[model samples]
Target: DIDRKHIHIVSVRVDETGKKISDSFEKKRSDAIRKELEKKYSLLPAEKQRQPENLPLKRVDYKAGDVKKQVSNVAKVVMKSYRFQSLNEYRAVLSIYGVTVEEVKGEVRGKAYNGLVYSALDRKGEKVGNPFKASLIGKTAGYDALQKRIAFSKQSMKEKAVYNRSRNIISTLLANKPDRKVFEKELAKNGISVLFRENDDKRIYGVTFIDHQEKTVFNGSRLGKEFSANVFHELFNRNGRQDSSGIDYEKQFHINNQDYQPEQESTAEAIAGIFSMEQHGDDYEELAFTNRMKRRKKKRKGFGL
Candidate 1:
């Protein structure tokens, strides 16, 4: 949230050609000044993202009705196209393709084994048919292969600063742009797409990033705690809210009331009465409302005197 009315002075340019203007190495000097200003103001740097070659432009289509084939295509493509750590992270990207995966753990011949099964999803995002075993699709999408892929991805990503670049871009977008749609659009320009999983209430429970430049799909929590889904939900859902995750609003309300002199005995009660309160999250507002109503009625008795 930024003030729409404020003039956020980013840069000032002067071009008085009459006196002090010089054309010698002007381009080089201007570039240096731009870098210095960006560093000083912590502004977003110049674009460095480049789309990779041989990447698939289309995603899986769920309406085609071939569950096994559709799941197979996206499963293999996602397994090769993205770099994800855990199985859950892998499945998050798959969801956008109308697919889901699960791990079946068991023992065979006194040895532990883990296997992957992919299922197709319907328009409602529910699994519609029998799940396809990893072997049925290919070994590349299997449990063992994915384990190796995860390790290889970690080693490769650790050697590059792509993670840092993503974090910087996402952080700046979130702070500067308040709207989620705009945030997503800006990210798209940087070769990144976000997948948010929300419950029926539309509160985001999980977040995944598909960075086309880096050819990686990973969960936001893997990037850092700050990029977690809860953080984004709190940010996008609230207004002028400093701390939504950990705040005892009831206690704060009591403290504020006790610290200030009451102009009207029923101040809290009158305010609560004007606004209908419902059961939300912790319902701290409900408690505050009831207490205010009680105090207001008590003060009315004093008016009778």
Candidate 2:
């Protein structure tokens, strides 16, 4: 219905008891996205256009308890700065900003819709207050916009080619049988944050890596199966004789050359067993024979023949 000066809109939600839900979802979502802009950008009532891209956005303070604005600021900065292909990957990065997002899909009054809900998290990783609809922020933070961003991020990550650097750092650490605390410390030193998602039984089910240097977030499996949660859990749980892939990370990727390498038998030894891991430290006689041969050569040279 239309009024003389303004139009009114109404909606409702009913609970299982057939009573109204009385949630103020619409009012909160309808709060203009321009509120943040006006407060920070000094926009006057006369300004019609949004801020330009060249202008920098003021970072929001998560401690201020402004969930909506905080979520919006984090989403904008992440969408512009980082490369993530999946919701989990995106959430891992947003989590650093004290925010999280969920994808929602359902039917209402015979209409089906898919959308995202944004929420703010506290220092302890608890939701602070009511969540906000994607619409409350803007199209930039909407579901569709994020899907496009994911695709573009995929391409951008490929072009950057920095994943290997992140991987080598992680693999080098894991290969040495480091504990969880040491693993995290080494990664942090290399500008990487690995978030492990675990369950009630303390079983690690998922993992995400955020590379601060490259500004990229990657799911564990996306990096490779070797970096998956299973690999990490096994490394910390089991004796760590071998990583999840059953390859000794230390020997396979021996970065420290001072570590001894097995002395080889004659070059004509069995070809099929070349990759064997056996090391022969009991060959004292062979070393003695080599020393004798060297001395014989020295004595021959001393003769000046």
Candidate 3:
């Protein structure tokens, strides 16, 4: 297993305009600099020098973390900026970054299952970063998470249609600028639930919206840039401001009038499933408690007519 906590520094070059040059461009520049250094180092007295050979000419083995950082930098810039719904889609994107995702055998729940690992090739077509787990590199790129993220696309033919319809419903509802609470409630009526992801700082970073009726899940960014966490936070903040001014934000928001029978109370379970998908192993109880409370409602007795 690789230790993910180690941080590594990467060398980069900036042009005269202060823009970071491409990796290939920077490598060419570094090669030129290396030749100059070698010339100067060769002229030094043998007794006064650390080594007779120039330091730049010495073979350098990059640390494991350094390799991880290199692969991740490419993955982040090329793979993450767009919506990818499946491992195939993810693999395709990785290829563009000069990397490939591979399936390997791994133990899950004490039984062996197919898992994902990654590899990249050098200019000479020599493979590097041998069989590193996707999770070891990043959470969102993990095998389990990718399965959940693209679960909708993997649905059966009939259910996949339902999933697409739910997507349309969610897309329309989000366009109305409903706050987080309102969005969840509204989507839940159609058997969809939104799962918001936060970091240690409690700032929203990502979201997955799951449709229980269709048995499918989708990343919010997969829907559109407007549906990302930042836009969701914006809607939430606007709702708070609107509520303080005594404005009925819900009333102003457009929702179809047709009586859509609300689905059964599956929101809590669905959200919990999302937590499981995210691999929050130690925080399961915490996530379950929070989601349970959010879905719980107080009972009110009604007068007999």
TM-score of candidate 1 to 2 decimals = 0.54
- Give the residue spans of candidate 3 off by over 4 A: 1-163, 238-305
Per-residue alpha-carbon lDDT of candidate 3 for residues 106-181, written as tens digits (9 for 90 to 100): 6889998866776664422245556567777786566676666455344433333544766688788877866555
- For each candidate, the alpha-carbon lDDT, in order, equals 0.60, 0.61, 0.49
| TM-score for each model | 0.54, 0.57, 0.33
List all candidate RMSDs to the true structure.
25.0, 21.5, 22.0
lDDT of 3: 0.49
- Among all windows of 10 consecutive residues in model 2, the one with the lowest summed lDDT is 266-275
Q: Kindly state the number of residue pairs that clash in model 1.
A: 1
Candidate 2 lDDT by residue in tens digits, 111-175: 99899988776544566688889898888889998899999988877753668878888889988
Choose the strongest candidate by TM-score.
Answer: 2
**How many steric overlaps are in each model, in order?**
1, 0, 0
Which residue pairs in candidate 1 collide?
A: 266-296
Residue 239 lDDT in candidate 1: 64
